[model samples]
Target: MAAVPLSLQVGERKFTTTKATLSKSGFFSALLAGPWEGDLLMDGSYFIDADPDIFDFVLKYLRHGILPLFYDKVKGHDYRLYLAVLEREHILGHFASPFHKISIIRKRIDEYGFILIWEARYFQVESLEKWIHDKTYLKAIKSTHRASEVDRIQDVSRSFSSELDVEYHTSWKTEKIYICPRRIFVHRGNPEACGRQCKQAQGTAEPEYEEELTVKALAIEKETTFNFEICMDDDR
Candidate 1:
């Protein structure tokens, strides 16, 4: 279909963009896949009924494939709003968290630098019972931190080779930011999943192990193309 010059009454103001522009989004592309006759107002521009404040970010992400990353702009409920729009659009997985939920990654300033403090995702590192049962969990966090130290080590004097770094590191003291993780968990899912059951995960080095992955993903933000994507409409 030809691109329609779409306009939406967001809050009280009007924002205009092309259907082709919005269609770069997996969400908006699907919404605009068919004729939008009645969605148009008297002015002949398609009207979107959505939270205008939130929709600005939505449209931005749609048009540019990036959610704003500024700490001030994207603080508090901004992420949840993004998740709300994405989930309602049935495109949450398009920008999924490692756990496939609305996990919070905070930029924490410390002596080490701005390390990513994964706010919502937490795993039990130990407890009175778990301490006696699982000392290996503590050891692993220390080991992983040590292992990720090279950040990347290359033997630059020999034959030229390129490789992707799979190693990751998080602070050994997660408690500095994450607070106290629950001692025992009967469920084995992410934070949102645990919240659904009114519980949190507890056991072993798994949560700490998983934290390694989260930190790695955040650490590679500058070095990798993991930030955003130009979403195309699915053939399905």
Candidate 2:
């Protein structure tokens, strides 16, 4: 069969692309084939006859690397096919985590960068900070001076003030910065229990829970001290 143009609309956003080769294979067969399950017409219509929840889940997986639990054993083959497609698209990792597929999340970061990923999720700056902290991914670099030394330096700098020095030489100053250490978040609940519950909710009478994945950046710094001078002269 000839390939057709496919268009998809999620919320107010619209995406247009060529239909996959399997579009002519009928909906069930196409779904079993994977990836093609998300194909659409140029007019924002889909050929697959799936329920809204399943369709939405597939779309979410495509856009955000999130996979909802599949409940029905009869639908297992189809669901696995969908997952395979997601894996191929680099939207999910090879292994499943507590909340998501780690590989897919990593791929999204690799492809879009952290800022974009956060932006796409509509996350607040505080959420970003919390995410980093909760994930243990970023760490703040600490001052090298001892507590006493830092206190002494601050006191001395705060006390000394000279007009002549202000005009010709500026005093030295110091501050701290942070960096990411790179860590992964493990799920808190039992994997089997979560899965089973998730599946049951899907009307499949089975149990399955979607995995959750968390991230955190680690921080590192050195312990030491150094002296420096600053020149504020306007002319040589």
Candidate 3:
């Protein structure tokens, strides 16, 4: 007598299967092993395994919630492949990548829950210091403080910004591009801690202050590059 196939239901949908055979082997072994038990459900339908690799890929994504680096090879080392996998796996709400346009990434993140962005340089001590000094002095004058207090605050802000800039530049040279997930819950309460954690997670060192600041500044500059473009064809 032949054995009956295993059956499972996820939400309102049901799946019945006899067994799955694994042909191509790699990180997707467990997902192709059969008769695999349990029904994987997302969005409303019971997810099905048609092509075992794609199915394994989807299952791995559903279970681990991340696209493996191998899949990213499809996009010529770009994040687009990763993005596609995220969409397929329904796990796009967990990453951010700055390499893609911010507006598009933001939209995807808002609608899908997360997006991936390549880490870019995002800070400049001079600009931040200037803002801080102006704000600090303006606050002192409004509070009826003496001119000396205003000057002192300005001096402190300038010095701090300068020191921070130095540290930022030094660090930037030693670090790699940082990648982070877009989901805040992944870090639990401290999104600021993402930088450190990402470096550690990627087996890299925390950048020195100068490098971090330089990268931050660079990111800001890159974002505003379009605004700085001159129109050569403008009517004189």
Candidate 4:
């Protein structure tokens, strides 16, 4: 009910933050929603078996909602270590090829940038994931030197069309729970079903009208308010 101070032990390193801040991450929110014997440590801190170095970036995202731009480098931060962490967490998948050439269009992205986006998605940070997608996805595509302007545009459009489920006569749908790059979209009412009753719906679709919405709807059904009052229960 209150802002609980949280100490996280990663390997030999210890990091501290408030439960409210940690709740920004869906992973941490679920982990802290109730008591768990596996995560608790004798030192009154939650033990997270992850690399503390890479987790520093994760904490920054939770505390400040920091979304780094493509190609932007953090001073004193090694990108290679970040990659290693992703590999260890299985965020990079079986191979690094999928991340390097993202999307079915095979658009190449900066490995570091893709890693950051993947990390946000992995943590289930909806806002941050959408921010990175909206702010950087196209820019990265545009800056790619492998393709010509027209080719890049066509490829990008086709790539996004498939990802966002673009349809000729139906309303395009935005993902309610998952976040994907170049996939944030406004959900206009189903044109094919407009002004029609549910029974008279077009094709096999139900006549359902929905308005344009952002990815914020991803967390709309969840309680996000965090009490700022500090909880002093050390035993917790």
Candidate 5:
């Protein structure tokens, strides 16, 4: 007997595809490999509860094996906001370049001569000389105590606005970018044992979301070049 092509409903939008395409995802392949012993929906289509607009992007990859050209079709003010949906779908990295913008930023930083530090925090500067050595688990010192505006979850890492600048004696500066402090989940460990004691000092708070860092780099400069690394972040 010939196999049935799988029919799916993602966020009210329906689509049909062969087993070969859907199986590209280990999650789906494993699901279909077994029996349909349980009752499916009356409509006979498997429903995937996900962001409808975002799934369109995933569908592109599943059907064509390429990133969606309509990256902006999803509703959101933030440019990289769609990435969170991709991460949940579990196929975030199955592409030629998952973080296209981040790749660009990294390339430009490399073209110059600055060393890129991967996980920069807001309180990790040289000021805490004594606390640094004696403390068993000093919370990653953030470089500063001020409010930072790298709000978009993705931009939190990719925004180069306030990051440590490469000191190559080059006069040109990149566009005003926000710096992404390596965010540490302060409450992850025991509160009392924390060297900074930030958790015990403050009460529990609401949940917060994280973004995958992404950016493209380069600001034209005055006849000078510097090499650098962008210890950037990725969802994968």
Candidate 6:
């Protein structure tokens, strides 16, 4: 007599396969070993209360050692379902770039990639868990460096625009530009020195300076090659 094939009913769907193929999984191996003989049906088909869709992947893997691939039709929830099935079936150490494929689906799911990593650990998928941990560490370092660069730029901008405005006064005679602080400007003949002494009155916040420098800067000869525009922010 021909041998009777092993039959299984997962959820609403029924399936038939050989004992040799189904026994590839330890869970199935135990089930076939008669420990759960009380649960076997009269027709000899084992009825499993599982999602047939997710269990289909495991059946294929048992038969041919094939793993799930990222296809256009595959959705983010499918990845989670696949992982859950693998865990339920006591499958381990058999991931073929699963996390990488899941990453492609992550864009549509939003934040699902991180959750998948945690699931990887929960399901004891060691290879995928390590890969996600390493990638997350590197991404965190990059984010910190990027934030630091933005802060540095803002600090430099603030310092340049802070109190005590810097003004440029050009002297045509020496063809040099004088960096005069505040309202002070260089005299016509001496391009290196301020036209007046900047005297700070004792116990006063303001610097008392003669108006002689402003008058001299305005009186500069018009034959100058380039004129430097002066701007001051009194509020600072």
Leading candidate by lDDT: 4
Q: Give the least accurate 10-residue stretch of model 6, judged by summed lDDT.
A: 224-233
Error of 4 at 59 (Å): 0.7
Please, what are the lDDT tens digits per residue for candidate 5 over residues 125-156?
11111222233111222233233333233443
Q: Which residue segments of model 1 deviate by more than 4 Å?
A: 1-4, 73-236
In model 3, what is the error at residue 183, expressed in angstroms?
73
Write the residue-wise lDDT of candidate 1 on 1-236 in tens digits: 77666676654669988867665555455556766575567887655544466566556655654333322211312234323333334434345331233454455445434343332211111121122233222222211111223322332213321222343334332221221246234433334434422333343434332332212111321111221221221221
Each prediction's number of clashing residue pairs? 0, 35, 29, 0, 23, 0
Q: What clash count does candidate 6 reach?
A: 0
Q: How accurate is candidate 2 locally (lDDT)?
A: 0.30
Off by over 4 Å in 6: 1-4, 73-78, 86-110, 113-236
Error of 4 at 114 (Å): 14
For residues 29-66, what per-residue lDDT tens digits would candidate 4 score against the true structure? 76677776766899888876555666776677577654
TM-score of each: 0.33, 0.18, 0.17, 0.38, 0.33, 0.36
lDDT of 6: 0.41
Worst 10 residues of 5 by lDDT: 118-127
How many angstroms is residue 23 displaced in model 1 relative to the true structure, after the best TM-score fit? Answer: 1.1
Identify the runs in model 2 with alpha carbons over 4 angstroms from their true place.
21-91, 95-114, 118-236
Q: List the residue pairs that clash in candidate 1.
A: none
* Per-residue lDDT of model 2, residues 1-236, tens digit only: 76565554434545444444223223223333555434455655644322333344444433333223333322322324333333323321222321221221222334323321110111111222232324221122112322222222233334222211111122344423211111112322333323443444445333333333322222222242211111111111
130-193: candidate 6 lDDT, tens digit per residue: 3233332222211111111221222333333221232323332323333333344443333345
Could you tell me which 10 consecutive residues in candidate 1 have the lowest summed lDDT? 120-129
Put down candidate 3 lDDT per residue, 30-120, tens digits, no spaces: 3344433343444333233222333443334333323233311113233343344433333222324211112222335564355544221
Order of the predicted models by lDDT, top scorer first: 4, 6, 1, 5, 3, 2
The better-scoring model by TM-score among 1 and 4 is: 4
